[model samples]
Target: MASSDLTRKPTIRDVAAVAGLSHGTVSRVINGGHWVSPEARAAVEEAIRTTGYTTNHAARSLATGRSGSLAFLLTESQQLLFSDPTFALLLRGATAALAERAMTLVLLIADSPGEQANVERYVRAGHVDGVLLVSSHASDSLLASLVAAQVPTVCSGIPRAGDTPVPSVSIDEVGSARMMTRYLMDRGHRRIALITGPNDTPGGRFRLVGFREELGDRFDPGLVEQGPYERDSGNAAMTRLLERAPDIDAVFAASDVMAVGAIDALRR
Candidate 1:
């Protein structure tokens, strides 16, 4: 075959010509964007199969100025986010949403400042149409980089204060923590101890605040502790809490995995 013919990727126009329909009709069927007559749809489908026509995502993005994709920037310590149940549910919801929109999802992990800088470059270069920022630490510079890039971003949780205005979606951590703490209080669990992870983040800070709020003036600040959101950290925190307040009736850890650690410590 000639180089020109060999190099040509089968496109919607070729499919349309083969099916004796307009390019718009082929586009509609291929993209599932609009309705088409049954007969014409069937003919177009047949042509697509025969010619092995595939939609070129890059070309479509160029013409439409939309990459038809979103990026999820996971900037936390991988062990924390990957092992946490909360992030697992978050992944499921985000995946389902993108699938429904017929868009692609690109996961970007930045565990260090250097990796984060690379992610910033990609964003500035327009590698994706939008981004979903998650688990940004107080000291993380990625937030500022993202803000400077001017990317359309939605956060899974708020970045630390002074981090730019990125819209986010998260449960009311303070409210949930307050409720949990109140449950403990209602059960007559007075000498309560708490294990929190990275008091810098919303989850840890809010849960600790809620515990204090529920305890009122009787709450001892020393009964609260902070740790790594890891099983080891949880185990250590629980041990320390036990040493510091042996008569504790209940303990609340910031995360479920940490809670498991607290349970392990309780058994010991």
Candidate 2:
């Protein structure tokens, strides 16, 4: 690029000029069009790299009537969102995926009704193309609202089956819990305790079911403690489990953060 153009951000026009092609051809190449010949695509890509041109997403979004963004909606408290490392990993993965498509990710935490209303309004305003629901509770009205707005959404975990056809991805929570419970038993830990997520969440509800089913006749209700998927809740639950069953030999916490807390309880 010339020194004269250094003061301003390079645009698609600059790339087109450098590529010796019309701006429309450059646009098609940038948008991943199959119509472009190999030579034309190569020229545009080379020009883009040479001129250091980046897309003006805002302008493109306005022209296409798409915001070029997706929401990472977490229907959980801000405390839980930040304290849980899993959310961080999920956010990072989502960000990377969106970056490849020249899209942006917006984060919205709505643990309260008012916050949910705000998120609903933002989504309804066409500020986002879709929502990537990172966490949700069975009773959260946000899911219904998203459905009513006719917004596309993909959930991180299996949400309660509802009329809204929102797609979701999840692990085998029940089998995972059952395997861990059995693992502890195999190690000859008879007095094992369980720390579980809240009943409103899929992980909280299904994992406990597996843990209970795996133990069968050996399960002890006195050793089970419910947690909110955070370290403090895990710590408190572990402490309570130990208080109720002083001879507790092992613990299976539903969340990693909770497991850390259980270890802290053991240290204490």
Candidate 3:
């Protein structure tokens, strides 16, 4: 080969030729190996390593009608999302999952109306194959717009009222809260206080309802405090609960950050 040819980037055809397989076989292996033989898969992988060939994602997307990209949409303000460890953990997990599937994740921060409009337009244009929405508030209109646009979407939590039915992955917030409250009550914590998330969110509303149901008649109005799911809010709510119900024996906070803040307040 000439020096110029030797330095050129390798392609799928080159990988197939090096692996002693058809281009179709190599393509199958690259696109998740649905019907390719084990021996063929091994050969293609070895050839890929030997040739240092990277997939031409744009070409593949053109052929397959898939962008191989997903969006992680955060509806909360950028400051709040960055301040919370939960968002960080979610982003890490989503990135790892998409990497395994040979896809990329696009982080979309749609905190303001203009940002939300731009994001909706991007999704409508099919920039990504799907979306993983998080931190959605009840008043958020983007969810409805995405649903109406027929863009594939999955939420990290249950959708609040007015959102169309979208697939989701979430814990049973109400059940878990009830379980926690029941455990405390069983342990003789009759004067239990509750720190709740914003009432507009499904998690916050359901958790508060669970706490009340578990506490029955013992659920005192004075012991209930509402706040954002942050350490400072937790601290403030705990402090207020303690002042109003000094005899309170235990507290149930809606989130881990809030729980830590409640502990801090207890310490002080």
Candidate 4:
């Protein structure tokens, strides 16, 4: 074991020493194991494993003009990040995926105008190579601003605001909702109440559309209630739905958290 590995974090030089190769050779292997012999690559890999060496992102950023980090930006209140389990799922997933590449994920929340400005500044300052935008609103100007600044951004859901079309990773929100509605209907559920998320979000808007389309002529406008994708909002929506239409036999909330809230209201 290298003394540096025990005393402090091991550096590339330490790895080179352990592998009995020059620092440049170690650097080449770290970059991608290309232009080096198989023997050299194997030795460096073993040394890296033995030393438990990690890339110094700060040094790498200065050298390559890349931050070696990505911002997991949430376009909602800071508290919402903790209160909503969906955000937690996204964070864990992104963290694990980035860990494999030895990259960092910075969490940022921008619900208000001030926070939005700060987030925009931080991202534009080259603190991160790109952004994974989450929980964005329909009219959110952040996407437009990021796009205008030529910053790389990929939304977690299909964005509805920008005319420029930001890159996104999303499931078939409409199809999923339609299927859920159909499933409920197949069970002989009538007088169904729809507890929709914020109308501006893709899930909120698209899911509502799917629910309405699935219901078709059976849809009751009075049974629909809109709220933020939060438990309390869901509870309130469900309570209102129950009060307005006591005959309601089923409901489809836009998200799992909201669905949980609706369940709470039913229990009450």
Task: Show pairs that collide, candidate 1.
Answer: none
lDDT of 4 by residue, 51-105 (tens): 8898887787787788878999999877778888889999999999999997889
Candidate 2, position 256, lDDT: 90
Residue 257 in candidate 2 has what lDDT? 90
TM-score list, all predictions: 0.87, 0.90, 0.89, 0.89
lDDT of 2 by residue, 1-268 (tens): 6889889999999999999999999999887667898999999999999999987777877777788889999988999877889999999999999999978899998888999999899999999999998778888888878888889988899877664767899999999999999999999999888899999889999998999999999998888898689898888998888777898878888899999898898899
Minimal lDDT window, size 10, model 3:
1-10
Worst 10 residues of 4 by lDDT: 1-10
Q: How much is 212 displaced in model 2, in angstroms?
A: 0.7
What is candidate 4's local distance difference test score? 0.88
Candidate 2: give the clashing pairs.
Answer: none
User: Which residue pairs in candidate 4 have backbone atoms (N, alpha carbon, C) closer than 3 angstroms, thus clashing?
Assistant: none
- Across 1-268, the per-residue lDDT of candidate 3 in tens digits comes to 2357568989898899899999999999998859888999999999999888998888988988889999999987787677788999999999999999878999999988999999999999888999999978887899998888889999999887766788988889889999999999889878888998999888889999899888888878888889888889999999988887788888888888888889999999
- lDDT (C-alpha, whole model) for all candidates: 0.83, 0.89, 0.89, 0.88
Estimate candidate 1's alpha-carbon lDDT, on a 0 to 1 scale.
Answer: 0.83
